[model samples]
Target: MSAWIEMISDEDADADLRAALDLARTPHGTVDNVMRVHSLRPNTMRGHVVLYRAALHDAANTLPTWLQETISSYVSLLNDCGYSLANHWKNARHLIGDDARADAIWAALEARAPERVFAGAELALMRYAEKLTLEPGRMVAADVQALKAAGLDDGAILEANQIVGYFNYVNRCLNGLGVSTAGDIVGYYAENEAE
Candidate 1:
């Protein structure tokens, strides 16, 4: 599907936007449709990249990278965002170490039955992600309590909630804008296979 907004092309970018676009390139050596969509407002895109890096890549984060990827992928799947789902799932596979397990975790998340594949604090976090995504209004202190009961300290719980919130916002942006996943899926899987 074509994006609702005109994706900014390198040829069309101004000097400032070109610099932002340069910073937005994926490891696969191309700008993502998400970034291209946001490129219409380069300053917003710059702030977005900063927030994204901090939420998912800050060195001070205590949550495991794989768990962060899992939360992201789970949130994407819950929102049925094909773009984010494919990309995050690919990253989760790289971190989780087995294709079947990665697929199973995704399936379990989709089924809302993570017990089939996850346990302990991981399961708690996934459950929290689900509740927060599907029913943010209904979420109460009890939800946070569950994460704590599962052994997540306050900081870890905060990080998990932020990741969940971030993905929910991003998923809506991509899905609402009809961001295409066409090239991304193929490129991501090919790169994964090479790795």
Candidate 2:
């Protein structure tokens, strides 16, 4: 419930901000707390939603949605953003559809042994996300080479990089702003079940 930025309620938003909020609403008919925080600057929030949608949800994307969610969950875990971790892990579970595999992936990531639960392109992608999140400056061409070796093309690799980078940026925003997980997946599911 604690947010460094004041949470903007839909009812209290200015007309323009309401328009921006409309673009940011979740499936449960509530705007994300992250977006509510960003609503402090409607224009920036609009730009953020545009970039976010393009980066993560563009129709032309080649990477499978499950892999994208995997990268997001891993990056969030690496950054220790509980809000993003919980939501993205829920997404990964929904897309992946195996609770044990999802749990193993999270456990492996936590243990720094992703290879135990992932292999081939999946393992490579996980390693790449780890490097991109933890030591971007030290990244070398061999890292991309590993992804290529894992059967990813240049375009897919590029998309993976963007997804990893996006989560890092977003995780920082959520973590730094003290945004709680109050209205994330758990709450969304709870509300749906009650309805």
Candidate 3:
């Protein structure tokens, strides 16, 4: 853990911060360590959590929950954030059910992923995410063209890009802040390891 951040000071929370925390507690079982630290600045943490949850709920792409989690793992791999990787990896198994597919997706992502899992449309979205996350400046007219070739309309592309960007942003924040990976999620992955 980074020496810079201390866990949130329970005794020192202001009224608004407490409210934000109260709101946060309804969904998350407990105040996560990362959330606890962020609770020191509750409003910001509230906004971040709200937006993240909303992004997950947004119905933009046709990818299944498990597949989305797979994409998230790929993003986490590139970002090198254990927090993001652990949660999404667990989600992939829990929501997607097919452990084989999750492992396959990870393998493909680590390798440059030639096969398209969702559809041509989702392929374009994943490719766009890879480009945006790995080499934003290198993205060019050709990238958009490829998405078009895969039959994604402008609206779907926009949503996909937003989701990718959002995850990338959170990955960076968590990485920089030294948030610990969830131990239960870590155990879940270990339990579900591919044979």
Candidate 4:
């Protein structure tokens, strides 16, 4: 366990974390440790969670929940946000049901994303996320057009941007504060019972 992590009791958080804990349906019980820590900044964390749910509900955003989680894992890896990575890595494992592939996807993406099965639109979206993260100002109309050409509707594009932007926000908060991971939330992704 890293020194920066702090667990929030149900009593400590506002309705936001409480709501998220219920929505996430964490396998064991309670919120993820990252959320627990973010419970310290309840308003900000709640806003992100609300946006994340909205992003998923938008019909144009075709990526499945697990795929979105995978994308988030990739971004967390790029940003070197350990707390984010730990949370999303567990999400990818549980949601995608292939931890090895989850690991491989990131490796493949880093090596050369387009070279893998995720070429074309997916690659474009990932590249767009990188640019938005590393150089937001550099993004031009052409990038959005490329995404449109790749078959993303405006709504999907908007949702993708929102999700990516939110993760960037998360990365900054965790990385800036030097947040670290503890084992408390790892059980959130423990194997579901109905398998």
Once superposed on the true structure, which residue ranges of model 3 sit more than 4 Å away at CA? 1-4, 9-12, 26-28, 59-63, 114-119, 182-195
Stretches of candidate 1 exceeding 4 Å from the true structure: 185-195
Best by lDDT: 1
Instruction: For model 4, give the 10-residue run with minimal summed lDDT.
Output: 186-195
Clashing pairs in 2: none
> Candidate 2's residue-wise lDDT over 1-195, tens digit each?
358878777778899999999988777777777677787899878887887777788898899888888888899989999888887777777777778877887789889789998899989999999999999999999999999999999999999999998899989999999998775554233345467
- Assess each prediction's global lDDT (C-alpha) against the native: 0.85, 0.84, 0.69, 0.68
Q: Global lDDT for candidate 4? A: 0.68
Candidates' TM-scores? 0.90, 0.91, 0.80, 0.75
lDDT of each residue in 1-195, candidate 1, tens digit only: 158778778888899999998888777777778777888799978877887888887898999988898899999989999888887777887888888887788778878899999888999999999999999999999999999999999999989988998999999999998998754433354474686
The residue pairs found clashing in candidate 3 are: none
- Kindly give the number of clashing pairs for every candidate: 0, 0, 0, 0
lDDT of 4 by residue, 46-112 (tens): 6655675676445556677676776677677778887777777677668877767766776775664
Q: In candidate 1, where is summed lDDT lowest over 10 consecutive residues?
A: 183-192
Pick by TM-score: which candidate is best? Answer: 2
Q: Write the per-residue lDDT of candidate 3 for residues 1-195, one digit (tens) a residue.
A: 222476554467788877776766523245555456587677777987777666655665554565566667777778887877777777776776667876666677778773645568667777788889999999999998898899877875665666677789988877787778542234244354553
By TM-score, the candidates rank as 2, 1, 3, 4
